[model samples]
Target: MKISFLCILIAAIQPFLWAGAAKFGGQRSGTRYDNRAPRDTLAHLSGWPQRANWAQQNSFEAFPIFAAAVLMAYAAGVPAALIDFWAVCFIVARFAYFACYVANLATLRSLVWFAGVIACVRLMCAAI
Candidate 1:
């Protein structure tokens, strides 16, 4: 697969990592991961775990526009190198965003989130 397409797969899978962190990361209060009531359990998480869950939700929220942008870039015949570059940018920014969220670095997270958005927008605009 092209790297950009692979990036889409990575993007799709990234949120699960944050979910796992929210459920399984250190700082839990004697409660096992409640797969049976995951959302409820996650909703009660605090500190970094809570932040991880938020990151997971944000990651899910971010995926569609990014995926559409990449596909649009492909359909519009954007250069493969440029597509790959922007996709990589998005992935890197997202990873940073996740870290910042978990670390409670709100300002840095917002900046990285903007970076990811810019990457997606660049991809979509390249098609236009």
Candidate 2:
């Protein structure tokens, strides 16, 4: 349940990267972005090329594991909690990965990525 809540929080806020976003108060001086797309303050820009990169990278980060988890749960007759845990991991890991990527923290990003993948694998194995 905690992970579920966190997952929703991640998903809800992520698109603010592309959508119009701004810091509420600044002398055009203190915020990373006072009047720019939130993506600009990010380590990478979000032009078409960047958006495509985001799409590809994010899909790789989350979808396959989700599909595997669902199918595995159905086929192996696993309980809902196991699948939910995997889904939660997928969501949280994506959040962590995005944060690390934006901050340009190369090493920690990979660790977070691997953790997510491992959580997915664990869920599948438990299902089976």
Candidate 3:
């Protein structure tokens, strides 16, 4: 399988990492985990934990675009090497994005988010 396909798999699970961090961090804020109403529970968290929750949600939001780009690129016969490069770039940018979010580096996080978007766009362009 192409490395880009592997990236798709990794990206699929990336959001859970942030979600887990948010859960653990929220526990630090004395917020009990409410399995029945997790979003409400997370809403009560503050500081880094809250940011982590947002990061998790953003990761979820980003996944579909990235996944669709990869699938479209593959279907359109984009070269594996080029697709892989952009896919890796997107994954790295996402990791940086998540770190910046948790660190409360709003500017850096926004920049990283843009970088990830660019990577995804480039991957999609490769299909044309």
Candidate 4:
């Protein structure tokens, strides 16, 4: 199936997040905290914000593909409203996912993931 630009956009974001990850710790030591280096291996291993950044970047990669699905619907001339609804849900879910992900809240992150899945279903239904 042909993916749309929106999907591509979502996919593109993951690498960008990865690129921004802490050189030694994702969120600290930028002269903010007294800590010279983050003690968390997650930050130092991958660097910055530790596990959160890793998870965030991992989750972030999926958006553009979802966006592509939305775009595909548009190109196929599906109703704009349907596409709009799906897009909004997708974006919101991703944001929530990111927030919960970085915070390391597994429960909320799962919910957010489900919401994104719902968005995909909605998009697929609309396209079909």
TM-score, model 1 to reference? 0.95
Q: Which residue runs does candidate 2 get wrong by more than 4 Å?
A: 1-58
Native-to-model Cα distance after best TM-score fit, residue 51 in candidate 2, in Å: 9.1
Global local distance difference test of model 1:
0.93
For candidate 4, which ten residues in a row score worst on lDDT? 31-40
* Tens-place lDDT digits, model 3, residues 35-78: 99998998888989999989899999999999999988988988
| C-alpha TM-scores of all predictions | 0.95, 0.55, 0.95, 0.65
**Candidate 2 positional error at 25, Å:** 19
Tens-place lDDT per residue, model 1, 7-51, is: 999999999999988888633655467679888888888888889
Candidate 3 Cα lDDT to native: 0.91
Output the TM-score of candidate 3: 0.95
Kindly indicate the candidate among 2 and 4 with the higher TM-score.
4
lDDT of 2 at 125: 83
RMSD, every candidate, angstroms: 1.3, 6.7, 1.0, 6.1
> Per-model C-alpha lDDT, please?
0.93, 0.56, 0.91, 0.62
lDDT of 4 by residue, 24-103 (tens): 34445552322554334344443235555565565655655576678678877887767776777776777677667667
RMSD of 1: 1.3
Residue 117 error, candidate 1, Å: 0.3
Cα-lDDT of candidate 4: 0.62
